[model samples]
Target: MNVEPLVPVTEQDIQRYEEDGVVCLRGMFDSDWIERMRAAIERNLANAGTLAIEYAEGKSPGRFLGDMFMWTRDEDFRAFVFDSPAARIAQKIMRSQKVNFFYDHLFVKEPGTLVPTPWHQDQPYWPVQGSQICSVWLALDRVSRESSGMEYVKGSHKWGKWYKPRGFDGKDRYPEAQGETIPDIDQDRAKYGFLNGDMEPGDCLIHQAMTIHGSGGNVTNHTRRRALATRWTGDDATYDTRPGTFQKIREPGLRTGDPMDCEMFPRIAT
Candidate 1:
């Protein structure tokens, strides 16, 4: 399989990402990568990681499942993390000297799933601190607003604000998390200048760590939404041993304020 991006990350893409805090890159991955990731997803569904959560269990029109750190256990995911073009894309867009592979988060929204993901900033939930942190959300299937495509508040990352992290069930997963609760964007959505739309398989969205984003429920009766978000940290990122945040993998044995280039979060590109 090709390890390079099918479509290169251009200067325009980087400019958009910097301006909007999010950018959609079409055809970033080829069909081969998509098919391999789809197979990996099926494998993950059969054997989920320790961090997997079924938020919509027993109380939904459909199912909502999420898992993280699959690369530590799954070969395909591991290969993708180190050999795929994601790291290169991240480094170019972030304009950093190097890139580190943080972790992979998978989201599966079955048809008719009605559990909306709460609006929040990702950095607050992570044990990291830096503007270079970002996530590459790759679509494994066709995605639309009706199929739970992610929506982001344009340029929210530059708001210099951090929102409290909340679970998909509208509950505080981290009671001790430090941040102001996010505003009710759903009630007054018109003012946010939200960005979201349809995406074909192999398309991906890259967003800054502090970008405020969330997704709606999958109201479709047949189409399922499956996406994998790979987190990456650039030159400025460092370990943050903040209290109240959830760490998916084992401790990296690094002190706070240290560079995140250990074995766990290995530097992938330079």
Candidate 2:
């Protein structure tokens, strides 16, 4: 099937993204695409079944589902990522002649869930080097402040510091930080700080791998915040599984500083 071509990203959008480390594009997807993705998610939930973690206990049968990397596992998702405009946008933003797929993460936050994602940077958790990676967070639902959407620290990507990883339960697992508070700031709620991401269905926000970001717990009733995040990197990106790093398990074959040109990270655009 011939999908509509992606609209060229505007210079204004690129400028804003560079300034704030994130930019939200509204209605980037058509209604038909959104519906198709929603349906695909529903199918994945039904067939794969939901993994009930401590945080997602007592929720709907399929309130939280994730990790749909092998697009062949779901036809609709494959079409959305390949046939849709997201890949082109990612290619343009990285300012590279080519862009490759890293992975796809589906975050489904059910209503009234108190499991907040801890403040973290994707770079520290990734098994790759360089700043060529970015995540395209596309909301599958109407996301609002009440629905616990993403919040990013302004220009945090340029800080060049990779902090220790924390659990999704918001606990610092590193022994050194024991009994100490996580010093990261929630730019959304901070006084005189910047919190610049709230998106609707078909609207997506892109952020650098090093950008500090996290989300609050869902406090609203019956608000489902589902996001489809597709990670991409430039041709220069490489695989690196640092020893003693949890990220190593995700990309086992990758060695430190090795070019990330494996089939898993296929070049989608050029």
| Whole-model lDDT values for every prediction | 0.90, 0.69
Candidate 2 least-lDDT 10 residues: 173-182
Residue lDDT tens for model 2, 172-267: 434332122336474435542456556778888888887778887777789888788988888678886664333221343656787777766667
TM-score of every candidate: 0.98, 0.84
Residue 194 in candidate 1, Cα distance off native in Å: 0.8
Give the runs in model 2 whose Cα sits over 4 Å from its true position.
1-7, 49-55, 58-65, 68-72, 170-192, 244-252
Runs in model 1 deviating more than 4 A are none
CA RMSD per model (angstroms) = 1.0, 3.8
Question: Residue 65: error of model 1 in Å?
Answer: 0.8
Error of 1 at 239 (Å): 0.7
